[model samples]
Target: MNEQQRTILAIASRVMSYPSESSAEEREHIDEAVDENIESADIRKHLRAALAPLDALSTRDIQEIYVSTFDLKSKTGMYLTAHEFGDSPKRGAAMIKLQKIINEAGFERTEGELTDYIPMLFEFMAVSPEDAHHERLQRRLANVGQRMLNHLEEENPYYPFFTLVMTKVFPNPTDEEVARLERDREEADLEELPYPIMYQ
Candidate 1:
């Protein structure tokens, strides 16, 4: 991808991550990105709208929202592979492969965070040089990203953030493709075990 696309992806990665507070440095980075990419006006507007309310909230409130929205809720999970593979061996294998790819790209995985975390995918996109490996990784991520978007409630504050990432990664997901993703999300929801028995 070009410099503008790289910048946009990096900004989105930071915006979608669980932040304790809206630091001035983060805001400045986003502002500089927006200023540089006039062609991406709609994306910039959507990102600003999504982040405005988040920026106004206190650190504690933001943390609560993050926990409740992502931690407490299964449908809005940030782990992309979990939506498709659940806790099965498939998900574990996928995670291993993804970690390998991320390592090969020279991006360090955050402790306690899976390689398939949505923000990490964006980070990979931002740092990895454009090549066949990047293309394959992006394609896989785009598929999982759409599935995550399907699971997210439209009214959720983080919905726009995921939507922005999906649009950037997928660009042109077909209607049929979205229908399949929605169906997969529904099936996954049905198969999900109750909270108490989930780990057993």
Candidate 2:
């Protein structure tokens, strides 16, 4: 990725993560970066619209929204693999491979977060030394990302930010790939057990 793309991904990763007291200052820095480097009018406009409401909210409010939106809602969970694999062994295996890829690129997941967390994916792509695998990973996660967008309310502050990631950062996944995820979702729904068990 180019410098502008990297900057945008880094900003998105931070913005999408749980908010902190420093979030306001970090947002200000993001705005300055956008003004200085982001030349595309469409990207600039969409990014600003995405960040505007987030900027207005206090850190605590944003934290509440983040938790309620992602943590509380199973359908809107931030772990991309969860949407596809639920608690299945497939999910664990996929995460292990993802962690290996991230580690190979000199990036590591934050404590208590899964390897396939959406923001971590963005953060990894932003600074990963190897560009060869970025597009491959983006395409792989595009379906899960789209499912997340589908679950989120259109007016949610993070909606447009995700739209930007899906449309701009990740290349469009093939129709077959999308259909496969749909089938997986259906199968997982049919296989839902009465109670949660290890490895699903």
Model 2 over residues 1-200: C-alpha lDDT tens digits?
67678778888788888888988788889899888878888888988987777777778888989888877776777777777777577888888888888888776688988788888888887887646677777676777787778888987878878788777766676788878876665234532233345694
Whole-model Cα lDDT of every candidate shown, in order: 0.70, 0.78
Clashes of each: 0, 0
The alpha-carbon lDDT assigned to residue 153 of candidate 2 equals 95
Which one wins on lDDT? 2
Residue pairs with colliding backbones in model 2 are none
Residue 146 of model 2, lDDT score? 79
Q: Write the per-residue lDDT of candidate 1 for residues 15-100, one digit (tens) a residue.
A: 77787455557878788777876367776687787677766767687677777777666666778777666655677777888888
TM values, all candidates: 0.77, 0.84
Query: For model 1, what is the C-alpha lDDT against the true structure?
Result: 0.70
Off by over 4 Å in 1: 22-24, 37-43, 174-200
> Candidate 1, after superposition: displacement of residue 30 in Å?
2.0
**Residue 86 displacement in candidate 1 (angstroms):** 1.0
